[model samples]
Target: MLAGLQNVTFEFGARTIVEDATWHIHPNERIGLIGYNGTGKSTLLKLFAGEYAPSAGTVERSRSTSIGYLHQDLLSFDTNESILQVALHAFDKAKKIERELEEITKKLEEHTTDELLHAYSEKLHEYEEAGGYTIEHRTEEVLQGLGFSNSDLKRPYREFSGGWRMRVLLAKMILQQPDLLLLDEPTNHLDLPSIEWLEKYLQHYKGAVIIVSHDKYFLNRMVKKIVELYQRELHIYNGNYDFYEVEKQQRVELQQRAFENQQDYIRQQERFVERFKAKASKAAQAQSIQKRLDKLDRIEDVTIERPNIKINFNVDKTPGRVLVELKHVSKHFKNIDILEDASAEIDRGDKIALIGANGKGKSTLLRILAGAEPFEGERKWGHNVDDAFYAQHQLEALNINNTILDEMKEAGSKKTELELRTLLGCFLFSGDDADKKIKVLSGGEKARVALAKTMISKANFLLLDEPTNHLDIHSNELLIDALNRYQGSLILVSHDRYFISKTANKIWEIVDKKIKVFKGTYEEWVEWKERAESRNQTLASGSAPVKEVIKETPKASSNGQPTTSTGGANAPINKEAQKELQKQQKMFQQLEKQLADLNKQKAELEAELSNPSTYADPEAFKKTENAYRQVKDKLASVNADYEKVFEKIMTLEEQQS
Candidate 1:
């Protein structure tokens, strides 16, 4: 083991941030650290890195083991130094050792005493142990692997943004290759392609890596262990993020059952005391039972917190059928046409996600659709359409003097004070927090407060711009579930892959200065992309082998074309195999989604049937029963189809192997 924390307890003022936290970090371990905001994840990392002194207990580290840590923010660095120069600092110690070795070599060349010769020999050994010869090449390789192109290496660090500077720091950490690496939210600014590349790099990486990120998909892909900090304690699960989730739920269930049994025991003891206390002969026994009750270990009831900002939105009254339509929507800014002749329709119940790279004008397009900005386009909206816009920067519109509660009240939702308080609490504000001036809130808090106000509008059309920003993974899931359950139109702009996969029914990709709309889940898009890439690779390889086969073929047509069988054998046809794989993957994902949906529907139908009022109408009851049976049959069919496709795909994969 490289490092370990045993019975560690840390506190801030009177609040116990972490209590009796015990975990291990060993070689080749990929651990994901997760928790709600202000749960001491960063503090625990600082403690592990030895930046903070623990209040109690000890942090044991392997003697002489090195560590690399990456902070969330990029601190200031030398403005004159280029990116390559900054990265080279990771090997400065090795270079110093090499210099010492050279000096030792010169000393040995002279006629020296026995003691001087021994010192020189020791220096040489240390230098050899440090691997000083290839440090430069190793540094360059790490830098290049982290998306630092040759041209970018020479650019001054000051010219790069905060995100790119963080990448530079990360490259330096990889070059150091310490025994333990601590990374916090490492994939925040990474694009999909870059994230995938990082995943591959980390898979083969040596040493132990502990990452703290809100990206669930990333955690699932990379981590083998999960550490969760909650309610002043740390919980460790020896598996990936998904495994941690399942185990956490199981733990909660077990806690509930234990608490229920304790309650029953307490009630029985109380009844015995009440029944026997008045009897003089049994008074001693009653007192003895009370004493036993006082001495017994009590079970603490498990209290589950409410989700952050649970939105239950519905369009009770339908608007004019059109909803939203854009005709030849041409948008431009500073004479640059960000969007030209772009048209899209947002009808009722449309959950659309607009995805694109940085500077692709996704936010600009959202602003146009939200009617927050004017453009050179013929945009039409349906009558009675109520739209609510939630932008990342919308918090700037709030009054600095008003409290969160006052702002929500001013939103004109006609909600009671108690209702407003509940809504505020859902977003994590409680008690005096709702009364705090808006000006004192952090950026994330302000954004959440703005989102709460937007929800108060009760609009049928919701336009969200990076709504998951500043949210923890759990909070992000809550928002996604809320949006998914919303019976209204949705237009979201986000770089969060898991969010898009869970919430988007349709995607509008901005590519090559235009938008291309595709109907399917994110998984389907991935399959399509892979298939397209395989086909392109096949076409690029050309038909040299086919031509050679045609020349050797005994049979030929009048036009000198080879026979069908000969051509088929010669064709470089790996694309068909890739297509088959893609099809099976898509089919499996579709089946999974369908089964989940049918199960939910079945549960709702059963609940309705259990209600006695439902049996009052015989025809309605019959229809419900028939619908439930049909869903069950459909679910069974889906399961069978899924198994068949899955087996075929696995067999095909084995054959390809």
Candidate 2:
């Protein structure tokens, strides 16, 4: 085991957070730690990280086992140091060996002693083994994968935002390659691409990993086992998040049945003792029954509290066919252009999901659509379309001095006290909880309040940005169900794939300063993207080219459903189109070959130029350099042509479909 807790009991003063929780983290295990907010998930991680000593029992870590922990709050970095310098610190041991080798080399230059030479050789070997020479290259690759550019790497860490800084810290942790890695919501700040990159990295990671995350899709992809903290105890599941859900439900049901049966038996015995205890003839027997009843161990009922909040969008009226429309919209922040000429029409009942990388205008687009932000172009709302926008930052707009009930009353003044209380109860605010001051509420509680306000707005159209951000899994499920049952239209921006898949039918992907609309679910979009990538890879590697099959489109039946073609009427193929496709495929193959040959020549020239002997001959060096430059130019030209051809092929295929 890399680390484990032995009957760990932790508490603050009188209140207990965890009690006798024993958990063992084994080698090469990807374990996900899940629990509701304030359930000691983070505190448990700290105990494993040695940042906290268990109040009772012990936390045991194997001897000399290196642990790397990435907290939700990123560590501060040196303002004077560049991003690259901070990342390089992960290879401290390798750098130290490199420094020692440099000193030994200087000493050898002064006097060729055997001891100095031997020391230099040993240090050089150590440096190579530690990957000292290629540390900068690896750092660059990791930073780029984490959404950093070469220019960004040269800038100081303070130049980046908090979310970007978190990515840098995550990169450092991965590069350090400890024996065990403990990550707390690592995907919280990462965009889709960065999340995918991190997933691949962790899949190949040679260490045990324990993560606490609410991203169901991420947990499903990264973890093989789940350790859930519920009711101040640990429940281990031997499968992924989806599997755990099914298994947990079954276990709860079984436990509830067993508890009910035990309760029935106890009640019967109690009734028999109560009736006979007063009778003189059976007094001894009644005493024996009382003793047996007292000795019986009571079984607690299996009760999991679901979120009390009922989120139902109050749709007063249906809007026109087109709920909203944007025409040539463009948004710019100082020198950075986020959206350019983005135009789209949102019809009634269109459940659209806005997705993109961080700072890529997903939220900005939502703000623009909600008429809360200014843009360069026209935005129009359809007739009778009343819109309510739920920005993630809206939690800050809540009245801190007011109570939860007061805040809800402000948004929903028309709601009666009983109705409002019922609504608050659904959101887990009942009686005393409803009277709690907003200033004293936790982040998750504030989020819940904000969401309840939005749901009570009774708007026909909803624009939600990161609605699931601070929600626990159960709350997320409740929100998802609410959205699914919502009769009004919605445009949501969230990183939770599972929630999106369950709610969105249309996808508005903001990429490269433009919005691309796809008429399908998120899963369909993923499949299409994967197919496109596969085709691109085929083109790049000069693999077997995709054949252009001129099959007739299937005809619809009387019911307007597509029917399978078996000796059915064949549609005539356009001969010219067929020839053009073949020509394009052949050209793509030729360009791939040319690019491969040019790369080969370039590599050979680079190798020759690296040799010291080549520099001894000036003419040979000049010739090799010129040849290398020519090949490099040729390779670039071929790559450009190849990209154009590949795009053309993809377009044609898309059109055919």
Candidate 3:
């Protein structure tokens, strides 16, 4: 075991995070530690990291084990060194050996002795063993993988923002390759591509990993096991997040059933005991029954663990056909070009998900749309378009001295106190929580409050950036449900794939200083992207793009009724197709036979060209090479023709069906 807890109990003052919880960490296990926000997920990670001691039981670890913990607190590490240098520090032994090696080289240049030479040789070997020669290369690779540019690598680490700083620390943690890795909300600081990169990296990671994240998609794809902290206990699920969801529901249902049955039995026994206690003969029996009832291990009734709050968005105004339009939009920051001559439109019902890697200007473009940032662009809002923008920075707009309820009142939403309190409850501020001053709220709480304010704005258009970052999985579901029922248009920037999939009907991505639009759902967009990649790979392999063949069919009637080729004939079309289909089928078969023959000839010629003995005979070799080139060209030609005919047949078959 790298590190684990055995019947551990943890508490903060009077609040118990966990009680008698046992979880063993094995090598190479990819685990997702999950729970609702404020459920002490981070505190649990700290327990494993030795940042906090368990109130009871033991935290065990192997003597040789090394751990790497990546959390938001690591952002406090200020450094002027280049990010590359900071990442290279992961190689502690290699760096120390490198310093000794440098000193030895300088000393050897002035005075050479057998002892000095011997020491230098020994240090060189140690450096090599410690991967000293390739440390910089490895560090650069890891940094770039986490979304750092080559130029950014040389900049001072302190120059980067919090998110970037977190990424740099993450890269260092990854490079350290400890026996066990603990990450708290790692995806919170990453973009879609970086999250994907981290997922891929962790999938094949040599060490055990335990991630505390709210990203359902990330946890589903990245972890093989899930550990949920709930009700002062650790519940283990031997599968990914999706599996855990199903299993947890089933467990809840079963537990509820057991509790109901046990309650019924106790009630029946109580009634019998009351009826019999009055009789002298049955008094002893009633007493024994009472003792048995008292001694019985009772099952607690099932209750909802997550907050049960409804989120409903009401659009007060109906916008015009086009809610917002960007005409020849262009944005530039210093020497960096974000968008140039980009034109796009958000229609009245459009639900757009703007997604891509970080530094690709997603948030910047959102600001441009909100008119909060200066850029060279034409942003036009349609008639009756009342827009509300919510972002992380918008949290600053809250009045620190005001309570959460007061802050909502200042939104000018005109909601009654009960109504506003209900809204706050939706954001996890229930009962007296709304009375707490904003200054006492954590960053996540502030973000949630800001989101709730935007939701209650009664706007016809909404711009949300990272709305799910501060929300737990269940809260995200509530938000998705709210957005699904929303009657307004929205353009949101988010890295959560599950959120996007659930809420978006359109996708927008910034590509090479242009906004590329895809009129489809997130799932469809992903499938299209995969197909495009596959086609690109085919092109790289010297294959032309498949040519789609089109055939004109009988047009439908003006009233949208089906039309037949054989004018009003009572033909099933199946019969007609079967008759004409034979000819096409014959041609298709002939083409396949011809294609096979050509491939066989090409293979034979290529084999002959590959033989060394054939090269010894110049004339034969030249003839073989010529034949091979001819066959290769012929193969490409035939392949295209084959696809065209294949598509033609498929079209014909589908139409008949």
Candidate 4:
């Protein structure tokens, strides 16, 4: 193993952030760290980076091994340094080695002594080992992979946005080729194409990697192992996020059973002691039993938390056809055209997704469509298409002094104060939190407030640009659910594949200075993309290979009626399969409702446990803890069941409709 931690413990004040956490990372291992906010994911990354030490136990690393870390808060650099110069800093040590080699070369040329010749040979060997010959090439390769074009290489760091500066730092980290790479939220500011490029580059990386991200799809694609921090304990699983989730559920079930067994044993011992305490003859036996109970290993009660978000859309009724039409639309900045003759027709109820490489005017086109920007060509809006746009830069556009309530009010929501507060609470803001100044809130909190405001708009046409930014996994899933059920037409730009897969009906890939519309769902697009890549590979290699495509077939309805689908005859659904799918979906919905109610009960129990008055009433506190554990165990089971059923429903529905 290149790195390992045993019985690691880290604490802040009386609160334990990590306790008895043990895990090992070997070279070539790709791991993802996942946990709730403030659960010490970033803190753990820092520990791995050597910036923080464990309060107890050892963090073992191979001798002479190097580590490269990219924190969420990117490092600052001199403004005068160009982007290329900043990236080149990764080779500072190698450059120095080369300089020493040159100095020795000059000295050896002047002095022909045997000692000098031997020293020069040793320096030359050191230079070669440090990759003296290809340092520049390696740096250039990393910079390009991170989406830095040739034109951007020489731009001063001060001229770049904070986001671009982050890219430069990322490039430096990649070029360093450390024994381990620790990246915290590396994809936060990356566009879809850039993210894809990074994924490919990381896939072939030779060193160990530990990434912290809430993007499930990204983690699933890139990681082989998952380490989850929960309740100040680290749970390590030998698989990606999806696999870890399944294994975690199983592990929690086992832990719950073990805890129950321990409790039963303890209860039996206590009863025996109480029964024998009155009789001196049984005192020895009771004492022995007490000792045995004390010696028994204690089981830690495992409680599972599900990724749940309360999401309900109040979108207006669907608008008329021809919701939006752009004819020969053109946009330019400083006489340089970003978009020219961009024309598209969006009908009512169309779930369109906008996709393109970075700096390809995807956001610009969304703004033009939303009427936030002016274009030269004719832009028509259908009657009843009341549009509400959630800009990608919505957080920056907010007034820092405005409260959450004020934003909603400005958005023309007439909801009662209590109702508005309840809505805000769903987004994790409540009481004083709802009244907190926007300036004091984090980026994520601000994004949630903005989303809450948008939800109150109830527009018939929604144009969202990267709306999933700064959102947790639960929130992302919630937004996807809302968009899936929304009555309005949606045109969204997002790098989140799962979101697009769940919500979009049509995809427009912006490439080669034009948008090419693909008439299918996200899954279909994936299939098409694979086939295209396979064909390209065959042509380049001068050989043809076997190709396979999983065709989606539509299914029949519950009453055995053939359901119509857009994919024509190719989309055929098996009736039996469809019925089974509907059955599972119904079960899932019922389980979700049950789980929600149980969670509410659990919260109430927790509140009772935390109350000082309840502690005074020991019986009540114990009862509340028991109730909380039971509810939590059941919630985890239901969540696992829900995921299984949801997957089945998707498979069956794809075949049916």
Question: Which candidate has the highest lDDT of all?
Answer: 3
**TM-score per model over all chains:** 0.72, 0.84, 0.81, 0.74
- Candidate 1 lDDT over 194-241, as tens digits, reads 677678888888988999998888899999999888887878899999
Name model 4 segments beyond 4 Å from true.
100-122, 257-307, 396-399, 405-432, 536-657
Clashes of each: 0, 4, 0, 10
Provide the global lDDT of candidate 1 against the true structure. Answer: 0.76
lDDT of 3: 0.82
lDDT of each: 0.76, 0.80, 0.82, 0.75
Ranking by TM-score: 2, 3, 4, 1
For model 4, residues 204-245, the per-residue Cα lDDT tens digits are 988999999878889999999998898888888898988998
Candidate of highest TM-score: 2
Candidate 4: the clashing residue pairs are 553-572, 553-655, 554-571, 554-572, 554-573, 554-655, 554-656, 555-573, 555-655, 555-656
Candidate 1 vs candidate 2: the lDDT winner is: 2
TM-score of candidate 3 on Cα atoms, chains taken together: 0.81
Per-residue lDDT for 340-403 in model 2, tens only?
A: 8877889998999988777688888898999989989999889999888888577789999999
Give me candidate 1's TM-score against the actual structure: 0.72
lDDT of 3 by residue, 190-246 (tens): 898888888888888999999998888999998989999988999999999999999
Cα displacement (angstroms), candidate 4, residue 54, comes to: 3.6
Clashing pairs in 1: none
